[model samples]
Target chain A: MTTQPNLAMRNWNQRVGRTALYLVLILACVAYLVPLVVMVMTSLKTAGEVQPGTIFMWPENPSFDAWIKAWSQACIGLDCRGIRVGFWNSVMIWVPSLILSILAGAILGFALSRWQTRHAGLILGLVLFGAFIPLQVVIYPLIKMAANLGLYNSFAGIVVVHIIFGLPVLTLIFSNFYVGIPVELINAARVDGAGFFRIFFGILLPMSRNILIVALVLQGTGIWNDYIVGVSFGTPDIYPMTVKLQTLVGSQFGEKEYNVNMAATLLTSLPPLLLYLVSGRYFVRGITSGAVKG
Target chain B: MATIEIRNLTKQFGAVQVLKGIDLAIDDRDFTVLLGPSGCGKSTLLNIIAGLEHQTAGQIMVDGTDISPLPPDKRRLAMVFQSYALYPTMTVRKNIDFGLRVAGLPRAEIKERVRVTAELLQITDLLDRTPARLSGGQRQRVAIGRALARRASVYLFDEPLSNLDAKLRNDMRIEIRQLHEDLGATAVYVTHDQVEAMTLATRIALMNAGRIEQYAEPQDIYDRPETLFAASFIGSPKMNLIPGTIRLADGVPVFDTGSDRISLAHYPFRLAPEDGMPATLGVRPEDVAPDAQGIVARHRLNEPHGADTLAWFTYGETNLSARLEPVAARALGAQATLGFNLHKLSLFDPKTERRL
Candidate 1:
């Protein structure tokens, strides 16, 4: 139906346009990846090789000495050791806090969706308002209350603090996920002899796989990297890795063991970085889907 | 099988009363259809009965037990939603087995019932697949299979066929009728379709503006509707309503349409001409056939609707539709005079719009 040369030129134009867009995207992705690559390569280098002058090259010799130093033998304050000082504490905090916050968000989401009881909208509004309050404003009152309750600087206190901070975002995510489910599904479940909890646990929970996985991965990243709550409520013996990393990098500045600092910084971000590598796309999808009603 | 008695059930949504004191008693194993147009409280009533919604004030008795306070799970009722809410993540086997499993039935019995329901609903091959992979009809079958597996005392269908294409809708309607006949289950179905209500219901509860206008068998509702709303709402192509004055002529009520005066039969209009009240005349389009010996009328328009044609003509300011034979309909609008059978005319008082 068309001339051969004209059709060929049109196809060539389309190919050029597509290739241009793909090239832009590829460049952007490379730009984002470069920082992580530098952190890893610098973590492998010796202190002399990691000097600012050699910003973009591989070291002539890579060694495990810096990694070992970052793990256990470096001086941080009076305690001469690595950021590994609170590794178990970080795991302990990250696990229980993540579990409790996610479960709380999901339970509240299901209750609000199903029962729709009196003052339910008001209650949900209060929760949303709680989320908008600045953490600084609540921290003083929370500390006072924690001290009054004999829980200041305790593991339970920190765990409870993480939960309180995590509620708004986690509730927002689960509520938005539950809202996306069709109301007809719940009505059908009701008519099929399922009560509220039964419908949530049996039907709604199973259908919410993509979003739940996204929630766990997100909460894992948030609590694992949290430094504010760790420093605020944790005892010296129970400090999380993030706080330990902060102190280690702070005091070991002059005579700057650049290798050890870079290694600790690299390790500080490894869990979340690896997590992002695996579940990154789904995480973004769920977060955006939760925000956008459609 | 069980009987359902709804005594003075009412519902209000944000100051707008939906179902205003509805009283109904569905006979045991009867297929009762709540028929209405959109915005009517038919669906609200169905939901109230299904325990998916709570009535503001009322009593609902099933099998002589008051179930007003019972949660949906304790009501022993199953409903097929209009959207056919099949679990998209589960296979047909899991979906149909859900209720049985919840009841703590043994695994073997659950499997056997799931197989039986799947086969009966003609979805045996689809038991391995999720609802997303099935066609519209297959999904509907799975929905019915899920309801069937429950074996509840009452089955509620909320416009379950409204989602299908016209052909599939009719096929499923026939299938539903046959299914009801085979099971003899006490089913309460809701639909806005006249033909579906007519063909499928043992009795119909015609609702309008949140009130039950009439409740009777399909033919009775067609033959003698209680109100002007029911009379006009129940039939296809609709009944023509002509307004005019009426007077008693030799002990028979005759309508005076200014141009022509016609004698009425079999209507109870005791109001004298001294009242001088306005009146409405009603007649079905199909009843206005052109017979050899009949009343004289003028033809105004002809509409060919395939299978049959509609003849529209005005005697005065009132327009009337009549069903004419295909040949006779074609002869219409060719500048010819036609005839009407006054024997089939339906007259109503224009002021109150009640049957005369």
Candidate 2:
């Protein structure tokens, strides 16, 4: 109307507001993506570019050298290998541990929910509380005991350790999920003459679709990411990814090679991360469904 | 299809005694209903008979075998829960036959039994459906079908119709009654709804705070309630009680219901206890009539429930009600009186509220 705060002032104010909003959004996006972007770029870069703090910049010449090296060989105190040396060993320990822990946790959960015996709350509370305990605190005693039994540093030893450590949280999650179910379901099963194990296999197990998926995702992730337990208890024959990754990106005395480290890290986390991304929607739905049931 | 005897059964959870010494014998085809309010321990008794719950002390003889030591599977009884407890993961067909297969029945017989039960319940279409996809009414039918498929000797229903909507509940109630008639299997049902108990039960065992108040035919329980709890609980809108003294008027016993008195022409039983001392006289609202000769009460509020009219009135401090015709209750907010037949009057000892 009148002067309208003059052309230059109005234009400058509009420009500033729009610029600030966009700057914020850009910062947010960069803040989140920087680590992942750096990881990918570092994986492609040579050793010299990584330590110079030019991580935000792109690799001068992108190469598959780090990928091949991480998969085949990169020295770690005479081993001269990357993630490959222990990748299969990690697999050997994880596959069985994940399977057995879920089985035990699921069974325990079913029993706690369906069968109403005395001390149900107490048992449930103990299992839930056990999940919060720091696993590192219990590692030494477990390792000593494992050695005492002459089962130390073996694949079976590590698998069993993973199972024992994994059971508490897995069982807690499963038990809480199962308790949301209607007692009427179990009662109907019982009235149909289905006993303890029968009801679990026939009724409870089948309905536990989403919870089982979530349990798989959770236990799979925990077992895959396990480090201290695997390193301390597992033998040289079965050192999983966590320990192997640490050695892959070892000391800073020599020019560090983050290229191979990034590749190794991404490789190790890929399986469980992919597992979660695929089933993340189901996981959310499972928890929300249980919340509304009660 | 066998008579069951529950003798001197008692159950205690830790230090708290739930069911104190209960004894009853049910016939081979009796539709026995354990009717009571919540926390009355009726469900506990049913579970005990089904062998799902063990008695702290006593014997349960099912078909003349002591089944106290036996588990629920071995006892051969079926139960229907309130929530219908349908297996959501399995199809209805699998849910019904899950038990039979576990019992090691032949596949051929299982199929035959499933067909027969589905036809009987008219649930042939629901066989392929899982419980999650089922509506409330459908889930209920599937639950009944589950027990029906078993061909178990005894059936226990713990408020099975409680989860259904009102209209559907009535329909299911009638269907369950008809099914019971057709099968004539020995059954024990537990429910808080006295209407369900009255309509479905051949004999109602009225429980009050873990004790059986009375056990008799529905008609007998209604017409002549043994205790105050049964009389108050077994009917809709409940009966009204007026504190009045009994006196020998006109050479016969008569009850003075505060404002007015009723003279018994000739009641089958004594009008009052041998020494009742005229404590409290109970009269059902339906029986209390709006007439000049009846007890007078100022009309306070009128609630017209279509077929019947419920009028709340007052005589001094005591507010009373009479269920009458709509036209009769049209003269609202006026001093009204109602006549009560002394022959229909129920006398209860003021202290214990037990009918005399």
Candidate 3:
């Protein structure tokens, strides 16, 4: 048995360690939240109030003028209309890109993991290799190919680029998920006369809700935040919010409007941020689902 | 009903050979069991028959049609897995009719087949529940109902009852046997439990190390084991194999274990053995009894098994086990005389391990 004084000393050490851990955690949280707090306070300030030495101060007379200007009246190049055009473009690009990529990824993943085909290993190796290649390396060739198909500087071109880039990683995620399912279940389906498409639609698809949610959150965020692909493949008429936001912030000639820029930045990021907050629980669960045997 | 013929079925994984040329034939409506320990290729053989695994070099004929090239669904075979691989997302009713639906049967026909199968398996009430909501036994019944609804020509069971508790296993074993008899269906079951093999199989193929040692009726395999391995593998307390020598006394053969001699005058010899030949005597624990006119042995231990008792004895240096009645077990003594039932004695050649 431990002595009374020794046990008390050990308990004191544990208390000190726990307090130190909490102190570190609170400091880290404050450090991360500072920038976000500054953004909100700065966006609330009017043009005159948003000046130097007022970074952490509250807005003296808060108004929605900056927000309204960012939404409908800000200028990018020659257009006086604000980022609303880019917001609609981003939505149009993201929806088709998300759906087509997820459908293709899920089917390819199911086939690669379950079916015994002649070139399955080679196909899987190629897909894995494709996932590691940087998007910048293939951007020029994809542009040339899109131009040949009469799709460059168009809305379809951006959606197609996102789908192509999204396929490799999404397939890998879905393939890993499918591999966690027991092989006996697959065999039973085969014995039950369920062919390739039937097995996917009937059995495996219904059980893939968690992994599909994961794919949606990941791909939605990536495609929405993409600026290079959007600006490179799209014309000014079809530029997504990221590209339009860059033009709105960096193209000003005089008297830079910090509040308007901050408001536009916040507006550009709100959709994906809301998406993550809404399904954050499912996102964590999906990532950790197959890690442990249930 | 279908007859399965497996000719020279062999399987190899890289350099390791799992099955070395197995050949067997099953008659229509016969319940044939492949009984062996783990890694003995019994499950591999069942998979080969079920078309789940391809044999290295073999031919499998079902009802005289070579089905080696067909897929599992085309082979007219249904399998019940050990894990009861029920589709977890669907209701039990959908699980039973999945195969029928896949085969493109009409709606009314699929419903009727599902109803008949559920009634036969007595799982009618469980049809609406999903597999996740059912108990272990109920899940097993649904699995069986799934296969029964398909009404395939042959049913393959891969250690179906091994997952149940003791009492449940016994109950399921009887129910499976009764189902086989009622439907007159051919079944090829694989199991390691000898009691399951003994109680359920019409014929037991005793296997060891990727080869069948003996294939015969259960009682024949138990009473007249053709090899030493078969003799030791089939008994509960295990057959006591006492090494001895056959000595000719006045031209009549007698087995001499160091401490005692037993006359083999009434022993049916497949072939007459030479004098002074080394042999091993195999006698089951149940065949040895306590008697006054017999060889004496020191009583070492008594194990009470509810209805009967097993007494261990030492004769010279060789240990023996005798199954005794409750009354005989009550008469405790330091030493006792034991008699070997001569009709049940098995003589094996020591070198070849084969019966002599």
Candidate 4:
């Protein structure tokens, strides 16, 4: 009929609209990628070539010397060692802190969401409210508490500080996710002779893979990029990579080496970047799915 | 199997009372169904028995053991949920064996039990597939298999077939009845459907507004309902109730409808009606017939069901229905005479609404 021609005309108009939309999206992607491209190119340039005017230009003689110097020979405070000096210390602090904090958050979340304890609503509200308070407001009190416990400027002190800050957001994420699961599943498990820990570990935990990955990537990035906590709580020799990198770049009364600073910054960001690259699919899916109730 | 007794069980949510002093007893291997409409506290009572919810004030005795203080995991029971709450991430095999695995049974024994349950449910091919891959019926079968693998003494079902389609629901109904017969487990099921209560329950506890109206066999409930609510709630087209006064004519009790008088000498009453007392007469549709020597009435409508035809007519100011043969129903015109089977009629006291 004559309606077929009208349908064809509408289809043509839709095609034009789609093309224009894709063109705009491509432009936006390029705008976001420019700063990352500049960082990589600046890291490759030699020390003398990294002048203020040529920051975004391609390196004239691209070499690995700046990377080698940033990794090994750059001076930071009294230590002449590069950002590599704090690499193992960061790993030590990050691994234990990540594991302990995630476990505590998950258990607390499961208990708060599933159990019928008195004042559970109050407890969850307090935790969510604690997430909004800035860390700088409580840093002095936290330092005083750590000193009273005789754990100030130590590895344990830094690990505890990371856990205290991470608990609020991690617990909020996990509790919100667990609240969406069906109550019948928990009842069925209880009727199957599963106790509290058994139901948590055997049934609920296995089905929480997506949310677990989301929590891991979030906590990994947050702990990896942390600088204030490390500088305040860590001794000179036990500084995490972020603290060491900051001191390396912000050295006063010394020649500023822009290439080494750029290289070290890139190196410090690689772990979290790799984490996102490897598990980006689950991150987006987890966040969107966890937002809505099943 | 175990005998279960619930003594004066009551539950309250804030100020609203959901279950008000319920008492029930299930014999060994009895399929007792708690039947009621939604918000009637049938499912709430079932949850209390399964230890999922604690009763506000009551004692639940399982084989002479009071389980009031115990957690749900300590109670040796299994439940089939309406949602078929199989673990989504696990395969059917793992789902069936999850209880056994948590109970610390040996691996070989757990595997054998799961195999036997799968074969019994005819889901062997689906053992490796996750719950997401199975259809609704298949997931329900896996849930039942999970409960069966536990071998618990008491099994609770909370409207398990409500999620299935109509055809699948009927098929699963028969399947569940057969499963109960084969296993001979003491089962307590909950449903709001009267047909399900009639077909599947050995004893049906009819509940309304957080109270049990009647607890009897299905035939007893249909033929001799104890209360007015039970009488109206159990039938398909509903029992017709006509209000009148009981008076004496020549020393014989008669129902006077102010338009016509009917003799009640052949009607069996639990207590004889006094003269000059208000009464209501109840008759099923099947008990009325079209006859030559009967009350003359004008036909209003004819509803042709598959098995029979229901003809509606006015008697006095009350409309009444009669179940007639399809062929006979087709022959009816605008006017017909209706006969009531007087011996099968029920008489109720208007004040108490109880059988007289």
Tell me the whole-model lDDT of each prediction, alpha carbons only: 0.82, 0.82, 0.89, 0.88
TM-score of chain A of 4: 0.90
- Where does the lowest 10-residue lDDT sum fall in candidate 4 chain A? A112-121
lDDT by residue for model 4 over A1-294, one digit each (tens)?
999999999999999999999999999999988878887888899888986658878999899888889899988887878889887789878998898888778878888897655787889899889899899999999999999998888888999988888998988888888899888999998988898888888888998888988999999999999988988877888899998888888888567888888898888889999999999999988888887752
**Candidates in order: C-alpha RMSD to true structure:** 3.8, 4.6, 2.9, 2.9
The CAPRI classification for model 2 reads as medium
As a whole number from 0 to 100, the lDDT of residue A66 in candidate 4 is 84
Worst 10 residues of 1 chain B by lDDT: B333-342
lDDT of 4: 0.88
| Estimated TM-score for each candidate | 0.90, 0.86, 0.91, 0.93
What tens digits encode model 2's per-residue C-alpha lDDT throughout A39-129?
A: 9888898877777877789999898888888888877656776678778888888889988998889888877766866787788788778
Candidate 4, B1-356: lDDT as tens digits: 69999899999999989999998888999999999889999999999888889899989999989998998988979899999999998899999999898889999999999999999999999999999999999999999999999999999999999999999999999999999999999999999888888999999999988889889989888877777778788887777778999998777898887776778998776776688889888778898898776677788999999799999888778888889999998888888888788877777787887888
> Model 1: runs farther than 4 Å from truth?
A1-38, A47-57, A75-81, A147-151, A252-255, A291-294, B267-277, B292-294, B333-345
In angstroms, give how far residue B133 of model 2 lies from its true place. 2.3
Predicted candidate 3 versus true structure: per-residue lDDT over B106-172, tens digit per residue: 9999999999999998999989999999988888889888888888879989998888899889999
The candidate scoring highest on TM-score is 4
Name the better of 1 and 4 by TM-score. 4
Q: Candidate 2 on B19-116: residue-level lDDT in tens?
A: 98898899999999999999999999988887677899999988898988877777778888887877777898987887788788999999999999
Clashing pairs in 1: B267-B356, B279-B350, B280-B349, B280-B350
TM-score of chain A of each: 0.86, 0.84, 0.95, 0.90
